[model samples]
Target: MKIPTAAGFVTLMLFCLVHAEICPLSCICKPLGEMKGWLVDCSSKGLKEVPALSVSTRKLYLQNNSMTTVRAGAFDNLRNLEEVNVSDNPWNCDCDILYLKLWLEDFSESSIANVICATPASNERKPLSQLSGNELDSCRKSLPIKCLDFFWRDLALITFAVLVLILTLCALRKHLRKIVLCV
Candidate 1:
């Protein structure tokens, strides 16, 4: 049997450990289970967006970062996400953030209650779950007006159908009376 050289063995070990350190951009990737949450810290890395994380992340702390925007559907795939701390970032209050805010509102179990904004407008840390209808309206003001127009069109179609049904019933009743008089 041939014996492997020491250099060859070291190279194999390094290859196995490479995946644990290959984080995207300014973030660091580490096995959270291996370090007890101490090695997976992603806060204040000057991240402009939320980075993709492994499925094992149970708690994510993103406070005091330079994140300026969160794209729509950013966290759509994170089904296992239990907690998220996104306070103290320069969040742009705009329509793109509306989807995230709406989703956060629908999912009562989400923990995005402390996300603060620092640009375009400064306000206290706002709870995503508490965003009201007026806030949604303000965000949606710049969106295409076709969405509302379509809603009205649908309503008109339903009303027309109901009116047609009522008119048909009236004509049927009048015809039945004429037949009874002729008999």
Candidate 2:
């Protein structure tokens, strides 16, 4: 096969460059493979928010940032994302971050370990991947007051039923006494 001429090679390179996805200005991007897409690195950038990523981003690195919360569906656009690193970030593991916790559980061990929770003392230092979806759901649902209300409602109903039963028994007893006296 004949080697490509300089002009032909330059044209090919230009074509590839034009078709390649551009990484966010705040992060560095490395092309992984034809099907894998770009690996975006936003580590140590002091980012309080996640940068807009290209749909072609396959892997993302956001370690050691100051992100307190990541909104739901933040990664919905990056459907091909395979790996992510946010281990050193001081994550506030509150209701707002519950989605991230649930999302982490869908990955493998290596990917899961890359994210560690920093806040909500109960979950501190825990791998985000290990957090169960149900647990996160519980965190998202502020059900304590509702549960207490149900408890009180049931208690009142039971107390009312018990009082009615006691009153019925007393009335029946008085009726039986009157019948025995008449007999």
Candidate 3:
């Protein structure tokens, strides 16, 4: 019933801070001894995309899922990750898988040996590391053409609207002058 001392409160806060681990949703996180790092296992959770991981994660397991392509820069924050397993997933080896390939080459080169493509018939069963940039899907190369198409369409619409507005203003000029004189 008595009030707790400041020392006891500080000890309680430190205990909570030491035990907290950033476990992602539907994932199991186990702390290494002495809190050296965490082993985040998110394998076979029916994951469509890679979940956000903590920076303290040293080992990550994300195999045997339905992931086709990971979003760009999804793994940019995991600087402390030592090992990652993303094999056995249906990886679409198109323009989208480039980010994962590049990140693996820089962070964990050995892991790339297990990443095999499952889609894009031409690249199917091919090792992601072995696929050259030129072999990617044609959509990436057509990006500039699509962008130019959008730009011209938008420009033509804007020009037509501006001309209509000018014509309407000119048509109302006589009425506007009369109204202004009365005011």
lDDT of the candidates, in the order given: 0.64, 0.78, 0.87
List residue ranges in candidate 3 displaced over 4 A.
1-21, 139-183
Candidate 2 colliding pairs: none
RMSD of candidates 1 onward, in order:
6.3, 10.3, 7.7
Predicted candidate 2 versus true structure: per-residue lDDT over 1-183, tens digit per residue: 999999999999986674444576678888897767888999998999888888988889988889977889887787787888877888876677776766666655675577777777877887666676445534646745677898999999999999999999999999999999999
Better of 2 and 3 by lDDT: 3
For model 1, residues 29-93, the per-residue Cα lDDT tens digits are 55557634323357888777788665555566677788766777766765665667677787665
128-161: candidate 3 lDDT, tens digit per residue: 9898777878645855567789999999999999
Q: What's the distance in Å from true for residue 122, model 2?
A: 4.3
Instruction: Select the stronger candidate by TM-score from 1 and 3.
Output: 3
Number of the candidate with higher lDDT, 1 or 3: 3
lDDT of 2: 0.78
What TM-score does candidate 3 reach? Answer: 0.66
Show the colliding residue pairs in model 3.
none
